[model samples]
Target: MSVNENLAFDALSDRVRRQILSILGEGGELTVTEIAESVDMVGRSTVSSHLRILRTSGVVNERRDGRRRYYSLDTEGSVRDAFLFLQTILRGGVHFDVEATKSADVAGEIQQDVS
Candidate 1:
C-alpha cells in the first residue's frame, strides 16, 4: 500500500475517528466544538487531534473562517482510494458493487449467528 493509503487506514483504525467521520459524513462542514458535542466521551482537543490525523491522511478537509475552523470529509481523497484498492483486491480485479457487498456481509453475519 502507498503512504497515503497507509495513513488513511491507520487513521481509520480508531473507533473515535470513525465516529468523527460518520458525523462529518452526515453534517457536512462542522466546527471543532460542534464535532466534540456530537461525539461522545471526547472533548474538543481530542476531536482536534483526530481531525489532525484525518487531515494528514487526506480523509478530511479543514477550512478556517476567522477564529473558527470547519472540517468536512474529502470525498475524492485517500480514504476513497484506499477503499477502491481494497475492493479491487477483494474482487480480484473484477467489479465490486458496494450495496451488494454490504448485503453479502449482512447475510454472512446472520449465517454465522445461526450456526
Candidate 2:
C-alpha cells in the first residue's frame, strides 16, 4: 500500500479511533472534550491522541480557534481514497461470499434508513 493508504489503515485499526471518527462524522466539528464525552470509556487526552493519528492519516482535519482545537472529517483524503480503491476492486467482479454480501447489504440498508 502507499504511505497514505497504510497510514489510513493503521489509524483505522483501533476501535477507539473508529469511535472517534464516528463522532466526527456526525456533521459538525467538535473539541477534544466533546469527542471524549461522546466516545465511551476514554478521556480527553486519549481522544486527543486518536485525533492526532487521524489528522496524520488525513482522515480528519483539525482547526485552531485561539486556544481551542476543533476536529472534523476530511472528506477528500486518504481514507476516502482507500475506500474508493476497495470499491473499485469490488466492482471489478471479485466477489465475496453471497451470504456475507447479503448481510452487509442489509446492514447498509438499515444504517441508511436510520440516517
Q: What would the TM-scores of all predictions be?
A: 0.77, 0.77
Model 2, runs deviating above 4 Å = 92-115
Candidate 1 clashing pairs?
A: none
Model 2 residue 30 lDDT score: 94
C-alpha positional error of residue 58 in candidate 1 after TM-score superposition, expressed in Å: 0.8
Q: TM-score of model 1 relative to the true fold?
A: 0.77
Q: For candidate 2, which ten residues in a row score worst on lDDT?
A: 91-100
State the displacement of the C-alpha of residue 62, model 1, in Å, after optimal TM-score superposition: 0.3
Q: Provide the overall lDDT of each model, using Cα atoms, as 2-decimal numbers.
A: 0.91, 0.88
Candidate 1, residues 12-76, lDDT tens digits: the string is 99999999999999999999999999999788899999999999999999999999999999988
What would you estimate as the lDDT of candidate 2?
Answer: 0.88
Predicted candidate 2 versus true structure: per-residue lDDT over 26-103, tens digit per residue: 847999888988989688888888899999899999999999999999989899878877788787465556767899
